[model samples]
Target: MFIFVGCAGGGTSSMFCQRIAKAINATDPNLTATFGGVNEVLADPIACIGDHDLMFAYGSIDVVRGYSAFDFGQLFDAILVAPQVKYLTVTKQKIMANYPTIVEDIPSEIFGKMNGEVAFEELRGELIMLDLLRGYQSSLQTASKNADKDIEILVLNADHRNQQLAKVFANWQRYGIRVLTETYTLEGLYQFDPPADFELRLLFGATMQLNQQDFVRISRRIDGLIVFSETPKTAFRDWRQQLDDADIPTAILDARMLEKRADVTQLSAKLTDFIQTVEFQAEATAGQIRLPKLQTKKAKKQHTLFGIISWNSTIK
Candidate 1:
């Protein structure tokens, strides 16, 4: 199977592969299948994956999902590190496809050491980074693993190599997870010509970059455009209203805001009347923030527990 790892194959993807290798025998009938990874899973170990038929690893170059044929290892002949000297050549190799930029002056191993460990502090002084350093990534990533962040419990588009009607069905089945799967073929091949970037500043948090094609793409994919940010942040009502105006599907994942705030209850109640029960996990914890805050369903449920012991005290 083609094991497609993602985003510069880092510690997350590598360790994840090792975790699943045990229970899933590669020799099984499942061929050309895929193994998905989040920020923590790595797609490395593919070269060694004997159970599967074909293997593919994606992500930044760290410990796992090392590199491929078009990778830097094979690109010594072209794409030098220096800029402005600009020696552009036309070869079969797609330059963007072979990244892992000839990492600066530091030796590969030393540089690897520094990038391997990333940490940041949040509300509770909690530091988050890749769980799997060099060890195999554990295979226990739940939809709630990174409950503290605006984590999207959505499945991504799986391996798209096999071009067939069946392939589309498989993609829908895998990525349509919990209703996150989407399909809208581009009218034509498209690319973001000039690179795009942005900065995100929070009142209580530092200014960070909401800069990725991924986020840009989200704008188009999500209809009604409510709930701009990922999770935990107070909903930008104006933004959410705009999305509601556009009529998009929505859900609330940030459990923290769900606790103290119930303004969205009106929207939830509407959802309750028309549709079947939603798919939600009881294990959900309070965390996350998103913008625009408008993904109205059939119901905006506003339920509260209010009780008083009105009876006279009885002898116990």
Candidate 2:
């Protein structure tokens, strides 16, 4: 077994997994499978090809103990981390990720608007995520010829910065990743009218506060796999019973509830293929780096992490 994790344009990755499942199933009938491994891994893609199991999860397995979805290198034959711009790194550990998404998400809108009053203790900056991705992509583009491996780009942004975002896209082209043309959307946000309230006026920007809950509530809608057996006493057993009977590993990824955001998928496949396969040289990808925005803080958390930056994924 092999495990690869990262921020992939859901479209291509989804199709890729489906196609892989098809090809794999053709080789053997008993191999169970499932698709859609997000920041975390999962059980299976198809219903009945093999046992349901997850090959990845949140956090470094070696650094932090106690996890059901880990120890892939020990249990499986190979390990892969197809991370987006940035992911935490624990050296000497077999586990890895495509990118590092801080399991944390606080609204930037609050810090920007705060009516200039909300005191935010220097948590982190927008560039922290973006810069890592840019450097990661730049490093990878410098290494591989496949272009598929080098397209790993990542970023974070203010809701109103789409104008500046145009400039961001332009910069990526300079790096060879060309995210605007390569990336695909993971999640698309729904528009909702903000509720009228006075507290929002003081705590956060009216535009953000009004719509925050709407975004958070939408989190329950995830693409998890389960089934019913239509049984007697309990009404029915889950269809995954076969997988359970086989004792296959499983991991659930709840991506529905993150910061309110949207997806962008209107990109060319030629670009997507190029971006996914890029990588960096051992010497360059070996050390640590910092984001410009963190310059003010003399004491900043500097830990080696994995990252990728592709423009086409989150633009919507």
- Candidate 1 vs. true structure, TM-score: 0.18
| Residue 3 lDDT in candidate 2 | 28
Model 2 RMSD to the real structure? 26.4
Supply the global lDDT for candidate 1: 0.25
Q: Give the per-residue lDDT digits (tens) of candidate 2, residues 1-316.
A: 2223222334433443454444434443433334444333322212221243222222222222112122231222122222331243332121223222222222434222323112112212332453354345434422111112221222211221343334434554566533322121222111112133211110101212213223211211111111111222342134235323322212221222122342322222222332232222212333222111110101112342112221211100
> Looking at model 2, which ten-residue stretch has the lowest summed lDDT?
290-299
- Among the numbered candidates, top lDDT falls to 2
Candidate 1 wrongly placed segments (more than 4 Å): 1-144, 149-268, 272-316
- Report the number of the highest-TM-score candidate: 2
Query: Candidate 1's residue-wise lDDT over 124-219, tens digit each?
Result: 011011111101121222111123222121212221121332333343346442222222222110121213221110011111211232332243
lDDT of each: 0.25, 0.26
Q: List where candidate 2 sits over 4 angstroms from the true fold.
A: 5-7, 39-316
